[model samples]
Target: MTEPVPAASAPSGGCPAHADVLPLYGPRFLRNPSELYREMRQEHGPVVPVLLEGDVPAWFVIGYREVHHVLSHPEVFARDCRRWNQWDDIPPDWPLRPFVGYQPSTLFAEGDEHRRRAGAISNGLFAVDQFDLRLRSERIADDLIDAFAGRGEAELMAEYAHPLPLLALAGIFGMPEEETPGLLRDMMTTVNGDEGALDAYQGICATMERLVAHRREQPGPDFVTRMLNDPANLTEEELIADLVLVMTAAQQPMAYWIGNTIRLMLTDDRFSLNLAGGRRSVGHALNEVLWEDTPTQNYLGRWAARPVLLGGQQIDAGDLLVLGLAAANGDPRVRPASDTPALGNQAMMSFSYGEHRCTYPAPELAEVICQAAVEVLLDRLPDLLLAVDPEDLEWSPSVWMRGLVGLPVGFTPV
Candidate 1:
């Protein structure tokens, strides 16, 4: 493990001047981030000094090994956002506040507490039967496909990919079918960080609170009930916070995983050639998406515990570090050329890594949901083809997530 330098205690050889820091947002980054990542790597090496929305300074960890090191050694790069040195400058209405703000959820927990909270989450997810999950996912996918099969043309993003995971989550969370629509609405808004995002966040929290209360009165064979019954004995408040985390975590990224995989199959000859035949190719496309266009491109992340030397750059105590997951996966030292197929390579930083990574069975369950969604969609619409030019596909504009705004496709009518 690398040690953090003492805070200004040693002679300071400055790294990059604050003025030279790259801006992480704007049209350039949103247009083609892969090219930008390559430029940053060449100019700044592994770690780049960058500015966020308000020109807030932070370090973007773009190296494969560098991201792995930061995630592995939480002692050097901590999760608790209260340690951030720039909070005073952050405005009350900052759009990024919802992400970096300290919450009671497991996302910012540390040490034994993180283990306890995260362990309970793992147990709850593990309680889910994989066979049952696959069946339910297939049912959800079929139902979604049925709604549009007769039309012969549909936007996969809004019509299929976005709704499948949220509907599946509703079943897992023991939500009444009638309420699933509203839950989906709020989750989509919150996850996209839209205009009403904060309100949507509050609404989702309220819904989770109600679900937790209902489960307390009448426990069921669901993820929430399992968490409530876990030996960790989480308080209602803790349960609500964590449930919100689980809900948000499950929806947007899972949707993108499905959408991106579908986009890959439609555009790439390798997977498109095998789409209607074997399941093995779907698995390959899913793995490829994680490496190339992961839903979470960058995570607003770990704060320095003290001054640290990472990727030959001096990081000050309380400075924020953004984990560039997509960039790390693209590192040529560890991965093949971006244009080359990364077949059979599953070592991507897409789901992140180490303690704070998506816990145990959660990743497995996610794969179950994704695979079922992809296979069932292809099985239902074997003739599916992109309705628009590949160049016309617009991605969601957030720096954090990588997903298409919509994926229009045409197929033979049922």
Candidate 2:
């Protein structure tokens, strides 16, 4: 836990514009957000007024119950980004625009429209053969391990953790083998919300457009084709845009899930005992990462559909509320002690909650991908150990993601 810093003055129960809000970005937050969440919860209740990049004001929902409340009551805290009242101040090139900027995607849709797209997506994903997915994931993992098994050392993040999910996803989409690497690059760039994010997002959309067009002409036993044939009858525009949303939702988080689980197994003594051949330990490590170090930490989030009092603060219509998933998982009212491993508990809010949560079989599919990636690597390199000190393994700097920058490790040569 990090040392406590002085909290910003509490919200005046009025417009957040005048409040002395906490800035959500910066090195401190990227380095240790749980400690900051703890301090914020102590000072202000669960809902704290916070400033995003460019001093944009929003509410950060940190309490377990409070986050559950916000997610459950979509009528009050809605998904539509257009309801935001700060658009007047936002520029087209804002770094965070990709998050709040409305597209025709299912991510920001609400009510019946959301169900249509979500239902189609769920059905499409449900159609995926879990056994086939596992087989493909194992093959991909084996291929990735082969490249580094001889060297006796590797940086797992770039070489293994990141690529495995994308590679598997590409196969599911029936994307050409040569096109996947570029797709992977653009997807990473887009999600990081950095300098080239907008361009990369456009590139992703263009690629999706071409894929949809090709599938329309020549349907196959792939996810895109399944969605195209769904009963929802999504328009070409909706299919293209929502395909981007699907990729965005699946790839990055799955990568971090694999990476964080491996990190836990390597660093924690409990997991080390079973590192060589314990599926049970691997399962525990994966679950524990979801509770303690969820990949999607904070989501760009619900807008207040109308003025309402919540957590002792009066939220005005059009106010934005960021869901604090990691913080909620650590809430003292519900979570176990910091030192205790959350082994069997699957109730963590890591995959948000409510209708907007990761839909049905999608989470199941992600688990198949992630579990296969970890199990295969362990089977191949049972003696894997961190090359650098545990403290030296730095995390990615993005406030939205919780993943290592790189995970360098070494093992005996095969």
Candidate 3:
């Protein structure tokens, strides 16, 4: 377990100008948080607490070393309700207040309860070699590309990244293919938006209820059914919640990872040429791409468990702390050679680390992106380049899932 690292320069807390907010999520930067983050890292320096959503307080910790400290001490820096900022919108009777009643996913859970659940679920990915589902992953990757190959070109993220991981979850749950579209739609609406997220969440909750109900009568060796069958592991509600957590685990990041990596390579002719050949260094390019830009802007919040001096500033037990994975990944202290082109994996901060680490198969995810998506794009579309000039493409205005809104490429139909 990595311990929280003190900010070498320390944090300067409290509200940044409201004017700065627009640029942070403005029409231009939302499409690419990295550009905003890079600019902010230069302007804001390191740690700064900006009151957001009209006075919901949060400390946006930007330094890589500082982010490590906060996540490593998750026992001290809790991920539960204490960190939530539910400013003016709380009805005393609301069943699931964003701050208090929410249990987002197992990744953010704290204490014995977190261990009770996380320990059980971690088995599927990291435990006793009980499930080596590698071949299944390769099969899915090949099939996805095979479906799109005849088109001569496709939007790799939508055609592949977005649906594939969700299908991996479906495959894990033994769900049928017909459910994939709805499941994909369900996840996209639920996770990406800040507005209407609560309503979108209700749809996901209802979908989970039905999925759970469907599985009870037709139990199997899938992740959900396995958890359902194990009385020691999951209660009914917990099983449903856990499925929501697991399904969302690597969904968007992997999608953005696929898109971002391809974008990075193709835009930079040097990397593009390396990728076109499908060398061993494709692994390196994947590493470099992840380090170059991560998908999510703000990390899921972690709270101060008790009073502590962070960055030499006093933080109360319940104060909210946000580790800017987007910022930290690019922080030169952690990555002095971040801008330098290299294939070495010095641990990209994209999926995050520590107790609240990513639940999906990222290495496999990277392999799939390279093996199927990136290679196919290069080999198939030799003449198929970005539809517009690289500078002309537009990006989604999302703080969390940064990707091109549309990548219209003019290609010869080979």
Candidate 4:
């Protein structure tokens, strides 16, 4: 493995009283976030000040209990961005504007509005047939494997991990196959903050709005239709926002989760042996990945409803607070000292908890997709091995998400 990158020094000294607003989007932070997290926890307790893309200051909650406390108490900490007093201060040209900006989705809603919008999502997901979903996922996996099986070498993240979820979601959303690629490309560009990210994001939302209109004219047994017919009675704008929410929530994280889990299976000897010997299932590998390297590393942006002390830090009513789901999962306080199996332990904060917990079937869907994809690749090319050193694998430079940029592998041509 490559030598670990040294943690970036806090803008001020290491003391909380002189705590620095750490940068969240720099290359240094992405290269060694765990080291930075450890330092943040050691010096600033749970609530540490950090700078977002435009050097916007916000409190980052890094402790296990602190994250739970903030997520659980929505009455004190709200998800509505309208409560953020510093919203006007954030410049429009900020790179993170697309994400941190206000939107009328369930993610940024609170109170009765949140319940209603979230209920629509829950109902749509509940209406899905798990058997059909798994069957489609397996078919997508098989097709993707078939495309590169004879090549004997491929970049799994691009060829397999990234496309699987997008294809499956296209079927779930009842979108035409031909339109899937453009949508995926645009959404990915937007998420990665590439050049013209805002334009790509607009394209994605416009496509979603068009799909919502088409679904209205021609309803089907898809998530969009179900959500449209839901008793929550979401308006046209809200329906489009919800569709965007479902698409973003499902595609990006699912792809990353599958890629990370496969990395663990191929690189970790104990996990590989357990799986090869039938001592552990793909679910076990997935759970380990979720605990150690969750796809959504940081989330749950909550604005303080009023001035209150949290994690020994004083905060104002309109200040923003973010939950460090990844940091909390690895916090020494809640995690066991030894490497214990996490098969049945679903307590990981990959999906935040309480009133605004992730409503999508992320964990279950990720398990199904990863299991299908990995099994096909291994069965088709048993000698598959990493093409580059494991340490050289590049991670996407996303502050809110943890994902590999690509995973290259080589094997004997079949």
Candidate 5:
């Protein structure tokens, strides 16, 4: 990683003189931020400063030009939040940062340790020569869609959304169906991380321990089995860590966004009409969903390795940094090149930018789910519509991840 850009010097005045701005403080700015962001962008132009960081003082970066510059410059910016994300490292005064319990999945890990595990998993999980793995995912998607199609007016979240990816995950890891219930509990624990949640993380660690031992003893064709069969590829610990990150990261947002895609279409007539056409148009619809409706809301939470000056702003060392992805994606300046008023474009930071981008990009993940989820549902029940109004749905109170608490949709009997 590059050394941080030197912090700009200033006189007795609180902030640097290069820019005229006040530190932003508002609940709406932190919580339901879209409205506040729009106002800030309009008034502040390309520089909108705000307070953030779970346990440290920092600036929330919320401008098109500034955010792009900061994200592109990773040396100064590192995704090393060991100070806040880890259990013991958290300061005694503050509550544990939500979702810190299960994050830092080798995805959030940095340096050689990160590269070794991420590379190992990337190779093992996505070795293109393994055509059988791709076929397995497709088959799993098909079976899942078929099951949901049979039920008219299914609650997409409970019936189809959450279950499909969990099934796919089971196939990839070679875990038994009987064990998935315990696994899901562990997965949800990651979402509501606490001391108890951290304890559940240990339960996950134990599950992985048992599974790895089993894989070592009885190697098979599944991902873990394949890696264990040829131990030369990665160290045993690296393999275990990657498995944990891959399984947990893969399941959480995949299921939520798959369900949310259908939710967006149900909420808006334009999105619905776009999906009514041929399969190729699915890409456009998916892009629209990613830009307009995000599952994992912000770029990964990051901490400064040292004091740095970025995008013409000075950030002190150890300060927190939040890249407000949803705001950037909606910023009118970087909107997609479409004749119609585009809801969003893929360049949007929804999947994030920089070294810590989501392992599964939104467009690709959505394409797979849409092809599998939509094909079955659309054919079986052509008139499916949302049971709840878009405005009425409750989203995660979470400022970091903009996901629906529940998305209720209904379909006529086939």
Candidate 6:
């Protein structure tokens, strides 16, 4: 491991004037974040200042060791957004409100509350039979491919990667087929922070409430029922909040992982040749993408609970910090100088770490779903090829997630 980088000193009374507060949104950063990260690391070390959607100042931890330290010491760094010092200053119409704003779920909880909520989520998800989940995912993949297999060319992001995870999650939650489409639309709208986001969010809440009521009346073998029966005894509001977390987490990251992995397999010549020539498996491709281009590039926002020195930087109480997962994964200290694959290496912080580390079955399920989706598509469309030049591809503008805007491809029509 590389020695952790020391933080630069700030003035006695406030944040250092020289701190580089990079804009996380907008076209420039979205286009080539890796380049910007490289520059930031070289010039500013790991803990750089950054502006969120509303020009909100926060620390962006980019070094692998530094991020690991920050995540490990949750005692000093807290998850509760109520600890944020400038929370009152942020306006209501911030574009990233839906994501960075406060929620009642475990994502924003700490200590005992985190444990309780996380336990409920784990119990709920654990009740899901992995085998059944795989089958469901495979079936969804086949059905989705069938829709575009005849077209000979299609945009995979919207037509396939984007919907498969949502459909699978709906199945796991036992949502009715009639209601799944509307639910997905509402969730998407909320995530994009577009027009009617508030209305769409309300729609989601209403739909979830209906689902909970129906499950209570007619219990079934599903995630909601499992949570309802868990010893955690989550309140009705807590149940709804946790369910929303699970659905959002499952859908967005899985979609991005599938899309990013597929993009790598289709565009990177070495990856494509290795997989085709039997030197690499879909798992290898997936792992490489996780390391180099993780779907959730930034996450795990923490507020400094009290005055502390982290990686030599002085952080006052209520200071906000976000882990740069993608940047940390590529941190030179932990990664090799060469581009060779590090087989069996699972040290990446994409899923994060410490007390809030993502419980198993969720991450495993995502991997299985993504791998299954890719295999089914490749098997069905053997000659799948990028419809546009790789350079022309674009990524969505997001501070927390990194995903392609679209993935257009051409293949032989079946």
Which scores higher on TM-score, 2 or 5? 2
lDDT of 4 at 288: 85
Expressed as tens digits, the lDDT of each residue in 212-242 for candidate 3 is 7888888866666667765355777777777
Query: What are the TM-scores, per candidate, against the unseen true structure?
Result: 0.94, 0.97, 0.82, 0.93, 0.78, 0.92
Instruction: Report the CA-based lDDT of candidate 4 relative to the real structure.
Output: 0.80
lDDT of 5 by residue, 199-305 (tens): 66567767777888877887776778866654346666666766776676667677666766667666666667755555544445556756666666554456667
Q: Give the alpha carbon lDDT tens digit for every residue of 52-169 in model 4.
A: 6656677889999999999889999988888877766667767666776788888888888898999888888877777887888888988888888888899999999989999988
Ranking by TM-score: 2, 1, 4, 6, 3, 5
Best by lDDT: 2
- Deviating ranges (above 4 Å) for candidate 6: 1-20, 195-198, 274-280
Off by over 4 Å in 2: 1-15
lDDT of 6 by residue, 72-161 (tens): 988889888888887677777766666677888888888898999898888777778888888888999999998878889999999999
CA shift of 404, model 4, Å? 0.7
Consecutive 10-residue window with the lowest summed lDDT within model 5: 2-11
Candidate 3 ranges with C-alpha deviation above 4 Å: 1-24, 38-45, 83-101, 126-148, 151-153, 360-371, 376-383
Clashing pairs in 4: none
Clashing pairs in 3: 4-69, 5-69, 30-397, 30-398, 31-396, 31-397, 284-343, 387-409
By how many angstroms RMSD does model 6 differ from the true structure? 4.0
Q: Alpha carbon lDDT of residue 310, candidate 5? A: 62
How many clashes in each structure? Answer: 0, 0, 8, 0, 0, 0
* lDDT value for model 2: 0.89
- Candidate 4, which ten residues in sequence have the lowest lDDT sum? 10-19
Give lDDT per model, in order: 0.87, 0.89, 0.62, 0.80, 0.59, 0.80
Model 1, residue 71: displacement in angstroms? 0.7
Give the per-residue lDDT digits (tens) of candidate 1, residues 98-202.
789899989999999999999999999988899999999999999999998999999999998888998888888898787677888998777677888788888
Worst 10 residues of 3 by lDDT: 2-11
